[model samples]
Target: MEHRVVYLDCYDGITAPLLLGALFDIGLDLNALKKAMAALSLPAHTITSQKQDAPVSGRSARLALDAPEKAVPWRLADTPALLPPGTLKELVRQPVLSMVKHIAQTTSKLQKLPIEDVSLPDITTLLWLIALTLGLDMLNVDENYVSPLPMATGSRQGPHGWEPLLLPEALEMLIRVEAVWYSTPDNKQVSLEGAAFLSELASFEPVNFSVTQVGYGCVPGKSASDGGQSLRLCLGNLSPSSRRAPQPAPSPVQTTLEQAESETDWVTVLETNIDNMSGELLGGLLDHLLELGALDVSYTPMQMKKNRPATLIRVIAPPELGEQLAMSLLRETTTLGVRFQHMQRLKARREPRTIQTSFGPMLVKVKYLGEQLISASPEYEECARVARERNIPLADVYEVARSEVQTLIIGSRKKT
Candidate 1:
């Protein structure tokens, strides 16, 4: 089936209203969206799309929501209480509900808060309704539909300060929606979570396509330059491929089992020697590096020349991040210089799986060699969190997560 490609150019920052307005402008049916909201038992809110003029993007869309009755704030746990009994099951189908659950899970992890403590803004619930109405879960497309850059506006406070403006659940929902494409130029400043979401969509290669339709969504806020705030949603279609004459197949290359088993990729290893830095400073720097997406960061005590004891900071990261990591080492530590080397690494295919545990849901990293499962371990950070929240030993949380994942895997095998 030919699927329409949708690109969200958030020239301004994105909000739930902006997103829904853009989708609406791009041909989403209002009645369907309203119907889904009714099924969810949410308070009545009116969504209207209107054309407005902007200095930068010219004609754009404006979306307004009216829900005066729902003035009280609600958390994720409050969702069930807000809706009628069995309303979710009766109104939302499995696919849409699954998408909603996934978004909630991602938001919970991102915020480092218990699922019950995490607040669901009104805009977020509305976005879910739009996703359900548009059948976002059923779209046929690869992850490449989203852009690489994080979503941001050119404001003076910088991207880090703008984090509060984003709704984590809404952001996750947008990324996983199959057919819809989210894009921005390379020069834009995207939020950290927005950039992370975009990275998941980076596996898709660019295709040549033409714009078939365009829509604009505008926010009521003012831009830094006193211009109007808006975003463009472009609908594109790939041109038909021309028939070509068939050619002879190329011969396959033969390789030994040892060679196949020894498949390797290059990674950058950054090292810096610090003798004068305090342990507290070094520890803080290490945490910061890990937060910035370092694959691994470790330190080893070593004796330097003249009997001075020093710490060797080692960072393992993708080759693309070598330069940035090196700069960080210089800026954040007392290191005058940073040395890096490209080393070959052999790794098994690894994927993350989530399992429900007594404490909560924990993410498990599972590794596979061909079709055979090799190693499965719960993510240490998540397990540690569960332990802290549940007032249990960390080891206990790990065991429960591991056992749950194993049971799930076994059950799936039996079904197959």
Candidate 2:
């Protein structure tokens, strides 16, 4: 059965409690939530959820720090002599690493520090790891699909006093929000894109939504006065798609995965190495390729002449688009030539999905045909935000999401 998951947008960003609140709002069993948490490190903290009126009407869950200042203290933990070859390999499971890195970078903006001096977890890598562990489908994050929030000019006090209001990016990085839009402190209006994303996720009409449970994660931010950062987690469930929505039946059709795999298709793999191009520029080019029908594009870190750091970029696409996309690469970056490969592909298909987790809602993209789900990835935005707030493993959040999504789908089928 096909399914579409709706997500609750945190306009101001997300908090551990807020995630719990959102799940409660949509209807999640508290007993199931406690059972899930009990499997993790315990005697560490307390999670309490209660009805609140301030943020409209919903239940709010708060994580009372057992040891207020207790965090995974970096200074106290083992320091890497050289970042250990695959030490970062663990980051694939830790979203906090990514959040911490993001916080460190954004803090550099607020405090005027160097990027190299900043240190933290690799949140992006961690989200990917967790999603992989849970067997949830992943999506190609279109950073180019940037929707900007309205800017508010003025001064406001943060942890410090009388400072200019931090822009959306700064706050988003600070609080670890997935998708955010700026607005006056007083609720008046919202960004068009932000509003649209929310409306689309919540409407649940032709696409009815059924929630399972919710969880919470904490956001960890480093203040000069404070030693380390924190995060919270939250989870929820939603309906996929309705097979019996009562629509007119179309003409009979038969599609076979085996036949699709047998079709002739030539693909070109483009590769290039340039030391001058910024990661941002390279990323943009990759985005265009995917949008232009390129099958896949990625970068691998490598060393250039004189042992200088560099990246080996690879792009795969149909042979017909080779020339046009090559031109795009040349025009967009400083690379002079792109290496190519001509090869035949078996089959290709991409499906986007949303799952209710103990933390919140996530959209996972899967690739497969027939009855098999070949690959899975959890929605990065959903996993990253909850991981930051809950101070739990991003992998665990992904695990819960993967488990719940399967449960919901299977449960729905049995009911019908």
TM-scores of all candidate predictions against the true structure: 0.41, 0.37
lDDT of each: 0.56, 0.47
Evaluated with TM-score, which candidate comes out highest?
A: 1
TM-score of model 2 (CA atoms): 0.37
Model 2 misplaced stretches (Cα beyond 4 Å): 1-4, 11-16, 27-43, 53-55, 69-94, 114-153, 165-309, 312-416
Model 1 alpha-carbon drift over 4 Å, by segment: 11-13, 56-70, 78-112, 121-144, 150-205, 220-224, 238-416
The digit string of per-residue lDDT tens for model 1 on 133-197 reads 34332232211243332443233443456442344544554455332334443223333223333
Model 2 lDDT per residue over 320-399, tens place: 68767766776577764555544556555767877666666678766655444555667767777788898988888878
